[model samples]
Target: MRSPNPRILYTALCLTGLSLATSVIAQDSNEEVSRIEQVIVSASREPETGLNLTLPWSRIDDDALKLTGAVHINQVMQRAPGAWISRGNGQESLVALRSPVLTGSGGCGAFYTAWDGISLRAPGFCNVNQLFDVNSEQAGAIEVIRGPGTAVYGANAVHGVINTLTADPRQGPEHGYAVEAGPNDYYRVRGEFRAEHGAHAVGVHFNGVSDGGYKDNAGFDQQKLTLRHDFSGEQWQVTNALEATNLNQETSGFIRGFEAYKDPNLKKVNPNPEAYRDSFALRAYSRWSRETGAGQLSITPYFRRTSMEFLQHFLPWQATEKNGQESLGLRLALSDSIESFSWSTGVDIDATRGWLREVQDDDFSPNQPAGVHYDYEVDALSAALYGQANWQLTSRLGLAAGLRLEQNSYDYDNQTDDGSACAPEASACRFFRPADREDDFSNGSINLGVTYALSDDHRIYLRGAQGFRPPQAAELYRLQSGQEVADLDSETITSVDLGLRGAMGGFSYDASVYSMQKSDVIFQDADRQNVSGAKTRHVGIEFSVYWTGESGWYAGIDGNIARHRYDSDANLLGSRLDIEGNDIDTAPRHFGSARLGRDTALKSGRSLTTELGWVHMGSYYLEPDNQHEYEGHELLNLRLALALGKGFSTTVRVSNLLDEDYAERADFGFGAYRYFVGQPRGVFLEFAYSPE
Candidate 1:
């Protein structure tokens, strides 16, 4: 119903033209310009360079991450285009990568999150609060693939993928330690060590944090450890990575009522004092590679174990739930070049066993007898076969295609009685257990693309892809009180993308436009029953630009204008609701960020950098009825960094520089509106030291 401001787009285009003109006039006809060096590994299974990957992708290197002194993933992901991360509290978040702030049990499964090369969780079981399991805070680099990923990845890559890469010692070794202090009695200590000897290398990273929360009865302390080892010979190599994390969090619940974020007193109140979350996770993976006659062979095996428990504060009935899983997986691949084509083929297999237990300890109103709500165990097996080929049809044209077939099976055993409601306290049972059953899903995906190089510094491409995801175990097993069983099918989304990206002189830019349609969408009805067979549509334009000046000044912008709406009408819990053409709840139509900064080198062997950033989120509906809307707000941030002699540096970060009072997340459910209060202006100071 609304469109972005035309003046903004005009201004950006004018700026791009001016930058191109400057590049042409500054160089002589005989002068040669070196192309920018770009390296990416997640777009494909192997290392590649430049923008010829035929997809929209981005990377945040270690240097940019260090300047922010960030403590959360949200802080570091700000520069990524067409992406958003909504922080619920200290370390909890909901991710939207070219989609809405997907909520509920199946929300987290939309985005495939991984560390190194393996996913953090199994396919059937994904925790909405899973990002805490990753060490992104200390990662050397973070790679993001927007829209549907390639066929090399399976299952939960419906929306996108985020891979955290471990630091390498061969890139030059340097050890560092840092300490930071901030408002609300926040304190953190971090350490890193790296060394290389001949063909062997090792790296270790550790961080611990303690925070006295701003809200009453809300605080947390957590720690993470990461270790990596790499050994290489003339024709073979072995690499191993290990990560462990422990967390103790006093989670916060939504503060009820409309415009609650504007109330100063309400922002400092914790409605659910009994809410807490505890979790421990361990992950390790190893890879072996060798050069063969046909091509290069690589095999990887990974293992993961995780346990977590938290109070369900969002529901009317207060319950405590615990869940854990252990899994083992293997991936083998081979890649080789023939003539003008490069091909890669791979197979992936994994097995997992997990359980869930929950009980109602308190009832908000009309108390029912305390009883078990859900108790079950699931054993799942998954396997996939995938292949991709890239061909250079001509000097200026390239073609790429990929395909994957996957199978997922679940064996569920109910530990509780199959019933319509919790027995003794039927009044308080918001969940029911189904009879033990076995379910299986077979899914496939195909992608095709073609790219043409317009010049030495410009390229254009078009892509079409189909992505799918099997039903999550929680969606099938965790049912509402009145529902006897959940009959749901796999969800799929088809997307078509067209765009241009390139680098000229000191400027780099990427622009894309795309449309998508999704089928068999699983969602909660008016009565809170989980069901499937709904449809939705997505369409958007994404743009990102950066310019580096010879005078040490830089400017960049990452923004998107998009629309997501219901595509069809369906029967919802005996109610004839016509939701066709309705805007998706919590999906903003206009959002983006801009940063202006400068870097300078001082005479005293020191370097200084300062940045001013702005973030914007447009208004959106809070209910499917479109009766309630949230007027989104904009915020400002500032950061200053100073690099001293002897590998020592200091950073000062100021969040909410304008002190805009807003909600980090908002929703209307069960006849009430809720919000997670946003933070006020706060300042943090960090100091680091490393030996040369």
Candidate 2:
């Protein structure tokens, strides 16, 4: 194993610091320094901290968590604009996003996303096993990088980024723990008690969850443990986090394709579906930084290993996968403006290896046995250099520009029998070919955006950016002939965005319109000349407005309208798919939500905050050709909170208030789309006590 060339990274850091000190000087702080619980980024991954607004951006501090009850990260995300979700028996079935890309399946592309400055999207489908599905209670402050991000972040940042800032030792630096229980046989208990003594802080957090799901046998359980430490001094600061998480749950199935909506009770009797999933993961990271008047330069090294086992009980299959990654990077930040310009740059590299194996299993019984299972492995390496700059040409006008160049290489090799053919039944026969393919490619993406002050409370902006995603091995190679696929290209998209923001009568609002034409899309070809090839166009509008005057007395509305079309004409029900008229598959034409809340003061500083929220999704046609369609959906959520003292508070929330039935997601067959009930109007309550 080879480590990163720190000698070079360190040299760059020194040069960057010298340039910063010579070019720009730190300006005096003037704006009110408000410590807000929520931070909403302005199109960039950089969050705007200390913001108090009702514009779909809600900050949940420890007190608010206790007052507006929600414990899980997923539940809190639903409160955000464009937050949509659904769950399967495996607890892995839940997938939520803001206008994610898709094929016959779901979540094809991502926007700006980062977990402590590292990308979270794994190679495989970023489904259940991949999501950092930890309980929200363990987090310190959940920072939401709102709206589409065109900034310099990791791969998964298409829609936006939600960075969960874990807890530190500062809140108490002593022993403390939390436990809670609720209806539906729901039970969860987490404890985080830390200790600090003179420049050193060390803490441990343990979380466990298990609940009898609203539907029969739909519950799940997971236990996560973490050890965190931080050291602060005049010359150096160090932080470390080591985590281990394991998931164990029974297979849960939902009616989809045509089974659901037909028989609402399909959730009973286990549904006899061949769905199951299990995974274990360990992640560790260490960061060290030295303070320079210019800024703090840090080095981060991380390692992660994840193991997954999936069994299709209803079917004749069994499989297991293992993934590992080693990454090292350096960050040099300069917060001061150099003669009126600000900039930041860094370089990073990631090396990953993943493998999948098919186990011999027969669903029919011991009388039936399959022979000679196959194993596949892939090696991928990526290196990228990125930089961002903000130049204030004048006090009223600003310019932002960024670019990233990435070089990626992939190699996939597997065994023969590469599958005795894609046949349902066959005797021992070596009818497959061999696979030894490798490809290396490079690409560059750029972003240019400008923000101008229209007056005092109004601003206008114009932005353009490009996004891309490389197809995984499975999508590139599907057994054929005697040899496996060895050639494919990356998918890319270019977008043009127009936006407007202003405030009126204590109301702040923002709206944006964007159009994108994507090319090099991977698709299944008839001749097998290329397993992936297609084109698409997406156009949409997004708007949000909110207020921030009195506690509880607030309201906000937000939503989007999109039109997705397929290029390179095809047939929809025997007719050439009409690009100009056909609706994109699963891209809901409309998605909107609104919320209103106010605190009813019973006495001085003693009040109850009650909130009502509603979300609507426009009807979407199941197929791209628009042959069939699923009706749109609407959901309502209600919450209440009470604060008794400056340091104590409690909150409760009920989601899916209407118990609406709809599909959190949809694909083709084996899809799992159903009128699955929401979290059963879930009720979550939390209590908090703090000393400042």
Candidate 3:
């Protein structure tokens, strides 16, 4: 049952009006209307040999995504199969695709996450779960690229890319907002405006949300502001943006799971396992292009700076945490195909700086020890050069190839001195001399692929590529623990991909199958050694379909299943893994999602749309002993929406429609029992208004 909040109740009432307005204006008389008159998607790379390929790259139009009733950009990305989101009991989240990054730790910080080419990755040890200005509000569309773009995107592009394209400037007045309040006293309100004056345009978005924890120590509150401006003249265009978010949230009490199940109402040491962080970002992009008799040539340059603070244990051992990362990149592309070849080359560079500190507390154990302290700074720099070429072997055959070379270095200095366990105001503390280390590392790889046209409407592609991720910070630090050693070299992979794409009978299908092997697997072995072993291997395949034409019906299916095993002593697992065929912890062997929906005209001038979706996750092992398993689970969700003319719209969303309880991942405490809790069923009504 939803808590009755006046603010949320008012929002529902407003939504009802949008539903009525859309219905009154939803006559087929304007069925010919189109939201976009022109589409330009080549921003990712220069035209490939198969410029005509119709691949099913998953995309969510802002209008449709808003109906999901999700406030986070990462949350909306869940619509894509194979993509995984490991959310914390409260606000933090860890994400990765097929090749999972060891959750938490700065090294596993999502294999990669970026915005307009700027890496959203933070420099904190918790980098793996950065949640700053990367909000989902005011986005025009989100493009989820399924596989690795190493050849094209470089280092951070190890797994996948979720690019959030901001909205374009509107030519007229616009005012739209939606408010939502639900069962947990969770409420959010967002609105924005955009306008264009000749060659100049400006837009802004503001949003805020609050929710009381369903359990002890679990409430959350957040606010965000985003702004953008664009200007163009002749053959050049320029754009700038700033996004900031201030989030203060407490530990929405854990599900109270311990080794020895205790009292139904047990009070933990940290009454509030609370954490709060502020994220700020500034970025700019400028591009210049001109038509050439040979083809089209364009040059783009980008710069960004982000700062974030994570109060490690804001509610308990709380101490201030600070992190900042900056990046600058420039690229030039000349698009032109001779009688048989087309080529493009780009160069990018990024540098990162980080800092960490342990704030001491005396509450629980104020007893004996240094009060608080902070560490020096650690910095890293990475640079890369890449080139891509495509050859038209003939009118029906094409070849594409690319190679990227990269180098990075790391330095840490100025350690904090241990206060003489007895000092006045902790002053006069000795400062450890700075110790710095630098290493030269480089990686080079190539991607070779081809497209064969079977006819005018069908094509087949066979792509095989090799790429790798360098040893991260954690792998190196683990050396001090006297456990697993080190992987002095780059962790690499070589995989084969087969794809088929075509457009026929108002239907389009783009499918692919991939089998990849991680050479010199860089995984923490059973002995906790970060050594090179034949174990870390990833093999998987995926299929996606999208269709929308004269039928007024839209349907999409996306799913993937991956099987992995390390070279171990286990005879039970076919891969000969050490655990005797026992799969890795937390890796779901089977996971998939499907969406079915239709678009139809309603009475009056409004339109009605309904959607059904299902998600399935296979069971996984929870403990190394393999005695217990986190059972598998399935979920069903539904949403219905009405679109009114202008920016007015309404939607009803039901999540966890089946009311099932299952853990997406396990976070066992020091206790013995397996602790887990799944999200309960939730429902919400949404409303919005936007006009051109």
Q: What is the TM-score of each candidate against the true structure?
A: 0.94, 0.80, 0.80
Point out where model 1 deviates above 4 Å. 1-37, 363-369, 424-429, 571-577
Model 2, range 144-237, lDDT digits (tens) per residue? 5433344355454444555555566667536544455667777776666788889998888777878776566556678888778999988888
Q: Model 2, 65: alpha-carbon shift in Å?
A: 5.8
Clashes of 3: 31
Q: After superposition, how far is residue 61 of candidate 1 from its true place, in Å?
A: 1.0
- Between candidates 1 and 2, the one scoring higher on TM-score is 1
Candidate 3's TM-score reads 0.80
Best by lDDT: 1
- TM-score for model 2? 0.80
lDDT of each: 0.83, 0.56, 0.57
> Which digits, one per residue and each the tens of the lDDT, describe model 1 over residues 278-346?
999999999999989979899999999999999888766777899999999999999998998999999
Better of 1 and 3 by lDDT: 1
Model 1 error, position 40 (Å): 0.9
